[model samples]
Target: MPRQAKSAAAEVRSLREEIERHNYLYYVLDRPEIPDSEYDAKMRRLQKLEAAHPQLADPASPTQRVGAAPREGFGKVLHSVPMLSLDNAMSREETAEFEARIRRFLNHTGPIAYVAEHKLDGVAVELVYEKGLFVQGSTRGDGTTGEDVTANLRTIRSVPLRLRAARSRGLPERLEIRGEVILSKRGFAQVNAQQVERGEPEFMNPRNATGGSLRQLDSRVTASRPIEMFCHSSASLEGLHVSTHWEFLDLCRGLGLRTDRANRRCASLDEVFAYYEATEAKREELPHEIDGVVVKVDSLELQRRLGERDRSPRWAIAWKFKPRQAATRVLDIWPSVGRTGVITPIAALEPRNIGGVTVSNASLHNMDEVERKDIRIGDEVLVERAGDVIPYVLRSFPEKRTGKERKFHMPSACPRCGGRVRREPGEVYYRCLNVACPTKLEGGIKHFAGKHAMDIDGLGDKLVHQLVETGLVKDLAGLYHLELDALVDLERMGEKSARNLLARIERSKQTTLDRLLNGLSIRHVGEATAKALADHFGDIEKVLAAEPDDLLEIRDVGPEVARAIAEFFAEPRNRQQVRRLLDAGVRPAWQPRRGGKLAGKRFLFTGGLAAMSRHEAQARVERLGGAVATSVSKNVDFVVAGEEAGSKLKKARDLGIEMLSEQRFLDLVGDA
Candidate 1:
């Protein structure tokens, strides 16, 4: 080998060791020595070196975290040992009963040491290693067999590809480490923001996001997400011995695997309860989502002696925190028409305080969800606030229900416009088919003049409602032909206000193609998707003429979204409305500027912009041929942070992505 090659190989080894030490400090010890930017710089240097000299790179290098190719699909892998579920203890009495039962089963009254660890709300998986090299990983499908997700697991940086050698003993010949894949609260928020930007359904919580990311057939997609793992237990192992559960966790940490540092070794059940109480008190502050604490027998001998049940182990019990639920009588079930015309069932409830918020209503999600939960009018139902924001009906108690409880049936006609409603094939939502429904029209017009859309200033919700209610504005085209005198006659509208509104509306007609597409209120086409469509097709006529397959060729346009766009354009009424709007001087011009200052860069803005509104900043970026992203990712070129910037700013700093203040951003865009 050349001298320079040898030098590069030595530096790579040194970098890997330093990086692993930092990972251990940050993940296992919960103590970081350096700033995230400094750490990221070291990582980038190692990655650049490894990329330049692949022959000198090691498989265990940190740069190889998300380097795997996409897999076709997950395969089935049988667990060597079964992964049993834990029995739950919902209350203090239940927990005491569980301890008494364990003592009775063991026929012993002696004090038993226990290990209490946070019960992470996430997807469980088993990672297998042979000769200290990571080999396979699988989900806990049915305890006996699981779907192999080795490629997806490899994408998580916290899961070391190679285990470190023990100081007193040789490397393990075989090991099966069990852990939970979690999306942190910050990561979940970031992912949901991306989902909303792409017009996809947002996941309910971090657990759902983790599960969905693990199940992706394409491993590359999983690689893009920030997933984490914490090894809690071992399914099987060889060439190692640990008499206690805490000792096993220590061993895991020594082996370059992440273990929760918050775990406590309790000498008695009282101590266990104390640990549980302490953990529950700090639950909301934890980065990852945890629902409860798991208490287990510390001694391996005692655990084996207690033995396992058919579904759960006798040695372990999960003491769950009380779910944030409140009993409320359903006053009524009403259908709400969304901008996309989907009718959602909402339950008006007697106001109850849940998770510190007084919630008066809960979403039934759809008719299917309502039916599954058997929710009825006047029925006493338990409502839970998912992620402490959206309230949902958990279940209804039929035995406690009064005779006045009324069964809710899907309305045959739309409630707002009395139009026909139909459920599409393979869909759970019932949609109003009438395009002219007043509810949908009102929603569409509101969205069209929204800050993120065409951004017509002075167009408030009241004005839109009055225009729709009085039949003054039948469609978007009607806005272009509105007379100033008629607007001045409306409630709260004067001559100056009417003239300013007219000027805003006229100025909105000269928007770009992306804004125009967004203003059209097409189903599943959000601001990001609209920008992608406009960038790809460049002309409105081209986009209209494109087939579903052609639309699918663009990034972020899935089959459902492509079909929605095609079906929307295929409607005769929609086509006529578009033609009328075009004839009314709604010209969406496409001007491609090459090599502009911000061209081809992706920018993300968070917090409040003091100098300008977020919509104005986005428009400026778009005018410079740049794109705006909703989440922080490796692909983002810069984050334009403003006042009170939150998680996105932290994430950008962690990834070593550039950041700009409002003034700096304006200078870059030549607006300063």
Candidate 2:
């Protein structure tokens, strides 16, 4: 073997050894001997060397660790152990009934103890360990199945790569713990604020951000994300001596796991409610977002006797906090134009805290919301975020008016660009006429580089902001025009990173029509709309020339949407932008024609489906060329009812719309 080959092999081995050492110290012990930058530099060098000499790279290379990889989509990995959801009880009466049911099942008339804890609003994941070392991890894809996220899971600092158990406690020979991976509300705000400053689209909530981050195929990107986790229960434990759930948690704590300190042992239902109420009040004050509290039977013996329902555990119940509504004065109402040109209203409020987080602003949705609520600039209004995140002003408090409040109206022009803003007929939002407003430009460029859009591998928000602020990128077309040297000159954009980014930028020109359409930031053209458009028009050129009548004829394309598409194409600037995007070689991936299986078949869903959630079911139906209506109309074909079939069931029967049970609905698609 050549001397250089041997030297390169040794270098790769040493880098792996160092990275593993740091991983153990940082991920397992929460201690690091080197700064993050230094560690990253070392990892980068290893990556470059490995890329040059593939034989020298290890499969377990630290460089291989991000959460995404241009996924066609995620596949379900059936869990060896089921991930059961908890039943919920909102009031003391229901809480008492939960306890009584457990007692009845156990046949114990004497007494029982319970454990209460805050239920973190986050994504559920399972960590698998073998012989004291972390081996694999996956998302709770569908309770019984999950997507492999081992690389991304390895990036969370609190998740230990190894477990230690004292022989006395009977540590399992092999172990798997199911838990929630949550982002701190503070962290979410900080990250999104940075993105906002860079003219990038911000996440609506922390859970959405956490979910998107965890699904990234590249571990390096996932590593940079500040994700935290809390273990709730053990899914499977082998060769372990734990006899109860409480004991199991204690053992987890002893192993240096990051468990909640507020988890308490309760003596009665009264005490449980007290804990729940206390947490409910302090929940907003915590650094993280929590929707509610979970109470579980403490004794393992009783839990075993109580067993579980088909979907939820009988041993535990979540007490969800009602949406916290508070009265506040709306000081002003203003519209912020996004990169996509969609104008949205932001309500400036007198400072107040809802669920512990300070509230100064809330989304007014659109012009209709403002008129419906009769919200004036100085009106005292009720705001809420209890079950739904993002505080919303509910209604006006007329009693507090004192004739001092003033009526408010949305602006007829873009505030930033001084351009005309028009609200499409029958649509909720008004849109900015200016295509090059600084914020819009920044947002569009950011979208063009996002994971779901252009997938430009190395262009983060910070870099994109620098480019725009430095006047390097005037529009979306500037991305394609960037030279490697120009990128390399920028801070943080090294030679390799610049080259990789440029390559991705070049490759992105060949992106699908759906991705490009979604990236353009068009009003009402979300991922679904983009997909439909791509399917209707095979390429960007055809889409640009499509007439309103032509578009309205397409499946899922309504008259209003078709008009929006036509209006967008009617603008000369919008046409010029399209030309630039094409000149820059950005290709769009367009899906081929999909048969409309449920065409002319209107569907309504109430409650939840056994095979999928209501939202999931709706999305699946639309994907297969179907329409979901809020109400059962004369044109409706099927109403899929779940376990708790609501008012929609009766209404469906009254309207004579065909109805399907959960099983029947599943069978229609062969999903049962």
Candidate 3:
């Protein structure tokens, strides 16, 4: 190894130790010697250095943990023991019925004991252990089957790879525990901030973030995500003798696993109801996200007596809190175009608390959302913020609906550009018929300059707005026509900044095909679609000539996406714009072929790699000419199995596809 490489390795080792020590102090001991800002700066430096040199980074390195990259698709993993969904008890009557059912099955005389814990609103995953070592983990895909996400699970520090206590060591030879994986509020905020910095769409809630993180193909990416898990139930077990669910939680804690500390052992349904009431009152005060309370039969023997019903275990019931709803009058409903040109209705509500937050605004989602809720301009309605974050109105109060309240009729023309608006058949959204609507132009420019799209630095939302408002930029192609002087004339655009923006714009003209496709901001054409288009077309002009049918032929491209792509290309004005862009020397980037020995073979990764970051590994494989698939199938040549390899690995084995260890997979890439 080079002297610089050895030094870099040492630096990473030192940083990891320092960070780990700090994490122990902060999270476990609740003490911190270093200031948070200083600690964060050091961590960022470590991340940058490690990202630049992946060879020096270890799997346990503090910089390698958090969230993973998004997967291409999710694969099915048939659980060894099915993960049962919970039965919901919305009222006291329902809870009584659930109790009656248990009594009918068990023929018990005394009151049945129940254990109640907060029902976390997040993705369900099963962690399998063999002799206290995390063997596999998977998502609760379709209850019986789920996607493998073992590599990602290993990245969670709270999840113990080995159980402690000399007597408890390997107490269970085989075990599978079902749990909820949630993104912490702190982690979600930090991740969202990073996303904002990168110009990517923010996840609406922690549940969405957790679900997205678990399915990521790159364990390294999963490691970076702030994911935590709470074991709820035992799906399967061997060599263990716990009689009650409450006792089981004690065992879990003894084995160095995490369980909800808020869980209470209730002797009767009255206690359960009281527990629910208490949690409901304090729900807003809780740091993590909890939708409701899960009440389960405490006795393991009694649970077996209750059994299961179709999709859910009859032994457990979830008492859902009412949707945090409030009565509020709609001030107005306004249309806003998204980056992809999808027009959305935003309801301006009378300032009131819905859920916990004081909500003055809520999304109507689309025309469907508006109509389904029967929302009107001036009518008083009930609005709810599910999980206390996203707000949506339910229905208008008939008594409060005065004759003066106006029915909100969606306009037939683009409000800003006077262009005709059209609603497609069977679709709920109304679109701007004019391709060159200033709203669309503004959105297009923003997408073009976005970090995940064109990555054109110096051109921001304010600058794009200025260019669009001034009529200097009509479309993405108009960016090339900009000069430093034109930019300087805009407010806040200094000479140096203007020159920088122009230079960045000029450089963006030469971006790769995927980036160019993303920059175009076609409806339903997101980052994934853009990559698929680039891989298929290999050039821009060919894509313009292709029909909707041709676009539909690509894997994962739906009819809506195809229609959007075709519509974008069919416009003469759009074609002219493309021509102008092409004429300005924007050449399409080359599509690198899968040329090595594993060229035709598809590989899907699950679980954490002990050595390399997922991004580094993916780049390495792609560089050597290998196709990295998102989901597992029979056609997959190999599944790269890592620590906690989940459902995908099992599916691969079931399909008789070869499975490779992380080290072996790395060796293959190195050979290529």
In terms of TM-score, the best-performing candidate is 1
Off by over 4 Å in 1: 1-77, 92-115, 132-135, 147-171, 182-229, 240-275, 282-289, 297-315, 400-404, 445-467, 470-520, 534-553, 556-563, 566-672
Best by lDDT: 1
Candidate 2 error regions (>4 Å): 1-56, 59-62, 109-111, 130-136, 160-174, 194-200, 216-224, 253-257, 265-278, 326-334, 337-343, 347-361, 364-383, 386-390, 393-412, 420-672
Q: On residues 1-672, what C-alpha lDDT tens digit does candidate 2 reach at each position?
A: 899779988998898778767765665455789999899879877876787688875435666553334444455678987888888777778888888887777777876788898889889999987866778889998888889888788778677665656436645678888888988877787656544433344565788789987887666557767888888788787877676677777777656456766788888878888998889777757878887888988888777777778878889999877767788888988887776576878899999987567899998766777787788888888887743357878788777777877776667778877788887676556778676776678778887678777777767768877898777899888888899878888888789888887888888887887888878766556666788777655567667766565566565565766777788789888789889888776666554436556533447788777877675576556656665666555545689888898888998899888889888787775531
TM-score versus the correct structure, for each prediction: 0.65, 0.51, 0.52
- Give per-residue CA lDDT, model 1, range 557-596, as digits (tens): 7687888899989888888888888899999876665544
Candidate 3 residue spans exceeding 4 A from truth: 1-116, 122-231, 234-240, 246-288, 292-324, 353-358, 387-389, 457-462, 491-500, 507-510, 532-575, 585-672
Report lDDT per candidate: 0.84, 0.75, 0.76
* Residue-level lDDT for 180 in candidate 3: 86
